[model samples]
Target chain A: MSRESVINWIVLAGLVAVPLWAHLSDEPFTITLATRAVILALAAVGLNIALGIGGLVSLGHAAFFGIGGYTMGILAHHAQTYTPVMEWPLLIEGTKSMPVIWGLSILFSALAAFLIGLLSLRTSGVYFIMITLAFGQMFYYFAISWAEYGGEDGLSIYVRNGFPGVNTLVPIQFYGLCLVALLIVLGFNAALARAPFGLALGAARQVPARVRAVGLDPYRLQLLAFTLSGAITGLAGALFADLNRFVSPTMFSWQLSGELIVFIIIGGVARLFGPVIGAVLFVVLEHWLGGLSDYWHIYLGLMLLGIVLFGRGGVIGMVAGRERSHD
Target chain B: MDLILLAEQILNGLQFGIMLFLMAAGLTLIFGVMGLINLAHGSLYMIGAFCAAAVAGWTGSFTLGLIAALAGAAAAGALIELVVIRRLYDKDHLDQVLATFALILIASEGTRWVFGSFPLFLDIPEALSGPVMLPGGIQYPLYRLALIGAGLGVAAGLFLLIARTRIGIQIRAGENDREMIAALGVDIDRLYTFVFALGAALAGLAGALVGAIQSVQVGMGEPVLILAFVVIVIGGIGSIKGALVGALLVGLTDTLGKIALPGLFGLFLDPAQATQVGSALASMAIYVLMAMVLIWRPTGLYGVRA
Candidate 1:
């Protein structure tokens, strides 16, 4: 096997081995942490489709994320009450099944992504970033105002939405579900990167004018990637809601968007498994530093500054340098 | 709505717009001259508010507090410009964004550590505390009126400085060609530091001035900062004239939309349902305006195309 292949295998093995050991030992906290890592990695992978392949610096992925969470929350609320969402105009009801929630999450996020991406993708550079941020805030304020859906206080799920025979309330089962979703998403991301469309997106990122000159509209490709990215992130948001059994406007906050970017950057932008490393390290640092004191963010800020200044490749890049150099 | 209420809202809008202009002015100047996007511009605003609150609390004088805020923000700006921002001039927008974002974290957390999470309250001076009657029999807060005056004064002063001053001439020249200006022995580093400090001072003044109306606290600058970004974008990035027009337009649009949209919707729909839909639409109104403007004129009203 090649060096990269060996490294990939070892990394994958370590991922399974660590979680498996935690599961065997009945360490709920560790299992929970691992589960969160997987879900967050999935979300970051969604972002990579736009940021890495499409060269779109979206500072508003949290909108889709919150949409996913709200999908679960709104649906679960109706499901628990056993009421149709809209009895007057249309008979739209909530679902108890996870599959239904996931479907809705993807569809909702895809639709939102299309609308936002249409306006945002009109501009490039800093303009795009600012517009996306504005749109995210718009959704955040909307959620905050819509008191029927819990508003600023947020909504709570009475139980884990059903997923066939699996009792999702169990940490191990939920973690397993998250891990599976994460793996599938990762596989999709890697395959997409090597796919013809992915190649075109990458080319557009490198040289948009050149791509345009060659008779391709970069905008359509970016919009498609952006939509796919939103759908995947929406999946993660659904899982996150289930993980916490709560949904709030805070999920859509710019701070959350910033954190997602931090995850991708700390892991190594555009690298497969970059967000994975970033999410794991970020959570681990938060957990560790949070245990030490209430003022952990100060130290976190300093550490981030150090990383940006000195360590450009993030932690994974440090461990695995320039894997299979292309040039 | 009554004419008094309308007039009051307009005054409020102008005050808010002026504050945005103060923030956007510096941002536009920096971007125009340096081609850098500093996300931590908000941090400077926060610093100013904190400085004002702290000074006022210590000395019990609002004027002194305002001065301290300006000086502190300008100093912090100069420090950041020299130590961090100077290196970012030649880098891509992404690098500038990330680095400045890191600065925000540090500044925010650092402020939180120094000052607890609870917001610091700054009192308006007793002299300016009461409402003054305007020409239309509308009662307005004297402090808010003062802010509007200060903003206009700054605007006029800035226009003069940029239009006629020797340094302003150099700045305009520098914006056009940095290398050529530098070759003429214009101490580019000092010019950059001065410009950065000037921007910081403007943000600080806005923060301190607005602190009277709002709470002085960490993260307070973020909302205003975003508004300022909207203003600059709408005005055309790197255009001072654009920033002024954009700020006023945004301030009026946002404030008026919040009041007008709900009322307009209520005229037809039931009050409760109207409120629900109108508020949502109002929140989205500015963005819709932004999108319309972008579609109509991508470069902005006064901004020259990049």
Candidate 2:
């Protein structure tokens, strides 16, 4: 393996090993923190496929993220209340099955992404960013005003949903579930990055005219990337809601979207495991500094400024060295 | 709707739209001239309101407070441009966004550090506190009328300044060709700083004026910032006239939709369901409107294809 690959392996091992050690040491709280890092990493990784590779600076990925959370929230809420989700064409009851939720999360978020992407792909750069944000705001307002599913107050699932064999109430079992999901997604990401679609998406971002010269429509490529990105993020969101056993409108907030972008930037944009490293770093900082001072965000802001100003390569870029080429 | 109520809502919409214009004009000018998206722009608005509120509290003069807001925001703008924004011109949008997002964090926290977490209050002047009679015997808040009037006056003045003066000529020239303007011996750096400061002052004025009607506090600028973004997007980035038109449409649509949507729902649904659905959908109307506008004109109504 190359030096960068070595670093990636070390980072991946550390991510799994550290949590395992914590779980063995009976530090469930630490495991919870790791779970958070994994979940957020998954979400940010989804964004990286679009933003870093596809050159789509989406400011509204939280809509997809929220879609995931709400899907889980709605299903679990309805299941607890023993109410059917729909009764019109055919009766459909809310389910607490993990596999079913994951499947539906992917479908719902993918469909939402497709519709959102259809409109947003027409514009590029700043217009694209603002339109994405607007759509997110629309979803946010919709959630806040839709009182049936707890509205502004949010929904809660008293019991963790069932997976095939695991007792998800066990902190380590649940953490393991999330970690497996994250690893599978990470593997998929790595494969996708090396695939033909990745090459085309990267080209579309760097030089759309050239890509068009070669006869591939950049818009369609971007839309596909967006849809896939939204789907992965939506899956992460479902996992996150399961981890927390609650969901809120705050998931759709622009701040969450911005933070996701921050993760990718800090970890190293376009890198496969960038968000994994970034999420770990973020959770560590949030936990440690949060204990020390209430004004930790100021420090975060300052650190981000320093990174943007002085550290272009981020952690992986700094340690593993820069990639050979990019726009 | 009653004619009187409709007229009142229209005026309210105008006032809101004008406030948005003040914010959007500054934002578009900066984008056009600098090719930078300063997320910290809203923080400057917050600073303006905070300065006005604090100064008004200390001096007991709303006029003095407004002056402080203008000076405060301009000074903040100039400093940020010199220290932070000047470096971002050649960088890509991602860098600009990250740097500016950092500035937002620093600005917000710093404001909280100085002002404390509690919201500050700013009272309207005694003279403009009451309502004024319009042509159709409609009553409106004098302060709001003055706000509308002030916004329009500033809009006109800004248009004239951009179109008429020597500096205006240079600004327009710089927008068209920065390299040529600099080659012609114009100080590009100073001009940029001036433009940024001018935009800041406008945003600050909006904040100060609105602060009187709403609570002045940290993060107050953020919602308005997003709304302003929506306005500029609808108007077309970098076009002042687009900003104006976009602002009016958004403002009127928002205000009127809030009223009309619920009533429309009431026609078909029960009172409770109508209220819930109407308010929810009304909140989403502007975004839907933006989507439609973009579908019709992808670059926005007045955006130059770049």
Candidate 3:
């Protein structure tokens, strides 16, 4: 079809083929790396909905990511210890079922996003960026001090959470599950991009006055996008925690949020497979350059600077040319 | 419970706020004039602390070390502005943020590579080391008191420079209209470099002053940077007066909440639970304050209505 779509297909094929090749060759580390990239890409895709589509530059997606991780951590922690999550109002039992945890994670994160968006959406531009960051820091500090759930030291689960008929303990199986999640989300993203809501949201970003002139509520549209964005990211977070078999306050750190943005930027902002390309490149570079020196971040910084300065539309842009349409 | 302890905490809050003002003022000025968000401002703070520590250790003169800090950070700031930040002036906040973020990674890793992992320590000078007796027999660290005086003095100096000097007029003019000032024959590039260095110097001074109280370490600037961001947001971006008020408000809220919240909670809850909950809420107090401020006045207390 189009050059960009061709590239997207090839990228998707490579993501699946690499992990399968690693599994066949008994290279578990590569599979783990692939899994990490997939999870991170999923998180960035969530961000892409707000950022690329709605033009909302949020520096606080980590809050939802952490919420998802902690959801998994708190529930699975209780499941492992056989303790009820709460007993004050009503008994809430901890669950190790991936489906349940995912649902709760999505629900909680969406609720949090709705509240945060209600407040944050009141501001725009640089204020929006700083406010979202402050919100992230708020969650981070709360996580660190809420000592009941392991606090700063974090919580570790001995066994991985279960998905039906899938031995997730095997790295490849887990990677496949993440890939499926990514693919499903990507499909949704593509559909949403073409949908009327997406069109209105895109309009709201470019010209709020015009969006209002057409009787559409820009704020409500953005808030909905932000909420959905948080839900998907929350799902990725649950998956990420399960992959690591641990959850920590570090998940909420501003650095993680920054890295998520970096993934979007590196892959090609608003491109369908941009996050996928960006995340894989980031993981590969991190693995490759990390082995070269302890101070590999210096090189990473230099590369990022070069990209921002000269490389306008990132890797996808360089290869596929400019995007066909603004949406 | 004790009035003296409360008074001392208030003083500590003031000192902290004033130091934060040093950081925020520079940040606000740069943002107001250039419309650039420099995430690496904190890295300049770290550089100042490191330079001060290294020089103080070598020359056995704290004053000289402070001077070295000022010069080093200014030079670094000017160099960065000339090389990287200069290109970003016309870019969007996203590009500005990413580029400056890259600078932070480079500065931090480069500092770690050169200084190694261990934190460098700067000692309080002999003259400012001991406690000073104040009104009502309150004893406070001379160094901290000096920090308050110095921060205020710098604040005053900044106000004067902006209010009275020839460059001050130009700076104020530039903030309102950049192209007009350039068209009026002002050397806009040099002025920008000068302003960036001035902001850098202020941050460096804060770093050097605070470095004595805490360990001079890499990544230390980030937390302070975030706090400074909160201050600017609360004060309304691009306003010096807003930065001052916002900085003090954050500092007081943070410091007082840490102590008062626990005591308040302890009145109702068990001591351990009170402490945990109080401390947690205390940590979040400033953010809550920021949120409330935004709700009340989206443009900030002193910000001109957008």
Interface alpha-carbon RMSD, every candidate:
1.5, 1.0, 0.8
Flag regions of model 3 displaced more than 4 Å: none
Which tens-of-lDDT digit does each residue in A2-85 have in candidate 1? 544555567578678888899898888998898888888889889988986777888889999999999999999999999888
Per-model C-alpha lDDT, please?
Answer: 0.87, 0.91, 0.93
The 10 consecutive residues of candidate 1 chain A with the worst lDDT sum are A318-327
Query: How many Å off is the CA of B84 in candidate 3?
Result: 0.6
Per-model TM-score versus the true fold? 0.97, 0.98, 0.99
Of 1 and 2, the candidate ranking higher by TM-score: 2
DockQ winner between candidates 1 and 2 = 2
Q: Best-fitting candidate, measured by DockQ?
A: 3
Q: Proportion of native contacts found in each model?
A: 0.39, 0.72, 0.76
Which candidate leads in TM-score? 3
Task: Write down the C-alpha DockQ for each prediction.
Answer: 0.60, 0.78, 0.84
Per-residue CA lDDT of model 1 for B42-137, tens digit only, reads 999999999999999999999999999999999999999988889888866656777787888889988998998999999999988898988867
Best by lDDT: 3
What's the number of clashes in each of the models? 0, 0, 0
For model 3 the local lDDT of residue A288 reads 97
lDDT of 2 by residue, A238-289 (tens): 9999999999999999888888989998988898888888888999999999
Q: What local lDDT score does residue B149 receive in model 1, on the 0 to 100 scale?
A: 96
Worst 10-residue stretch by lDDT in candidate 1 chain B?
Answer: B90-99
- Model 1 segments more than 4 A misplaced: A1-7, A323-327
